[model samples]
Target: MLTVMGATGNTGKKVVELLLAAGQQVRALGRSEPRLGALAAQGAEVLAGDPGDAAFLTRAFRGASAVYVMLPADRESPDYHEAQRAKGEAIIQALRESGVRHVVALSSLGADQPEGTGLLVTLHAQEERLKALENTNILLLRPASFFENFLDALPIIQHQGINADAVEPDHAIPMIASRDIAEVAARALVQRDWSGIVVRELLGQRDLSYREATRIFGARLGRPELDYVQLPPEEMRQAMVQAGMSETFAGLYVQMTQAFNEDRVQPRAGRTADNTTPTRFEDFVAGLALDSANP
Candidate 1:
């Protein structure tokens, strides 16, 4: 059996869907009972609980041969880094107890760094912990900044009439669709394709900038002349805080953007068909525009 954490999230749901379609036995888990019920009705063994609880997760991991692991992004956490570390530690402990021998970890692009990657430092720390597990075979999927992150800018654009972030407009970064990440996760779980420790970089169709993204969003929304602006670090942190991120997480996120602006964070491996994903920024923005119109 294959178990998936964050089963209600974008990547988790897609992974579950793909696995179910492949006629695999899946245990879908998340904190939301209502969401888990939907997966249960679709023929998955659904569990709803806090994954940070080692005992609970141990039970969830029990009887599964492989598991998809992630520390879901939680902006509301009062202490984001501490919370993520706790969750990661719990996952490690649970895996050790349950004897699930294969794992597909959802990690970020800059997670290779031991420090100075801001929001990614939590992931970096967790990756190290996962790497130390002797018995478990681990595959870490280090994906680029998700294109869906652009959705967060919709309100800012609609209200303020500009595209903005702490990262400079000219800085191009690798971006991927969550669906692509899910595809890799589902395949890794079902195939058990690699032994020992493996890292796969899932870069999107192209390197894109907020400036170029602004043009796409404008074109998709019929705005024609929208502009992209780089906000100061403090200003960006305040904006994210007001938008519901904790002050600490917001500050860390700003630092991550700074790392991007200064070219500190980048893909560790060269591009290949194995690492590239198909979805384009245009396709994502088009879908986003449709959702906005329908909503």
Candidate 2:
């Protein structure tokens, strides 16, 4: 059996669906029973509880052959870093206690650095904690910035007529769809072919700048004149806070964008055929446009 944490979330839900479709027994964990109802109906054993509670996680991990784990983003947490640390510690403790031999963990491309990467620092620490497990084999999937992140801009674009962020608009970076990440993760969980710790970077179909992506998005939305604005860091942080994110999360988000603009955080191994995923930003935006039109 495979256990999946954050089963109701973006990549986790996809992983659960893929596993069930492949005839694998799955235990899906989430914070809300109601949100997990669909997975339960689809034949997964659903467990709802706090992921930051070690005992709860231990129970959730028990009797599973492998586990798919990720740090669920909580934008409202007052102390976002501390909250992440607590959950990371709980996951590590449960993995040790449950004796799960194989783990597929979702991480980010900039997780190699121990500091100054803002939100990504939590993932770096989690990677280190997972590596300390004595008898377990772990696969650390370091994927690029998610293409899904752009969806958050839909509202701002609709109301303000521009895409805004703290990053340099012309600076190209790797970005991927969460579905590609989930596919790689689900396959790793089923195969369990590697021993010890292994890291794999998942770049998207190609490197793209925010400016180029915005043009594609604008064209898709039938507003080819839409512009991308590089907001001042302070202004961006204030906007994020006004949108209901905690001050801590908003600040960290701005810091991360600064890191990106400075090219301080990047893939260590560079892009290769093995690391490049199939989905293109254009394809992802096409689906997004269709969904918004229908909705």
Q: Pick by lDDT: which candidate is best? A: 2
Q: State the lDDT of candidate 1 residue by residue for 1-295, as single tens digits.
A: 9999999887999899999999999999999889788889889999889989999999999999799999987788889999999999999999999999999999988899988989999999999999999888999989988887776777888888888998898788888899989988998899997899988888998898989988887787778688999999999999989898899889889999988988888887767777889999888877764554421
Provide TM-scores for the models.
0.95, 0.96
lDDT of each: 0.89, 0.92
lDDT of 2 by residue, 1-295 (tens): 9999999987999999999999999999999999999999999999999999999999999999999999998899999999999999999999999999999999998899998888998999999999999999999999989988877888898889999999899999998999999999999999999989999999999999999998998888788888899999999999999999999999999989989989988888888889999999999988774554421
For every candidate structure, what is the RMSD over all alpha carbons to the true structure, in angstroms? 1.6, 1.5
Q: Which 10 residues in a row give candidate 1 its minimum summed lDDT?
A: 286-295
List where candidate 2 sits over 4 angstroms from the true fold: 289-295
Clashing pairs in 1: none
Error of 2 at 227 (Å): 1.3
Query: TM-score of the candidate numbered 2?
Result: 0.96
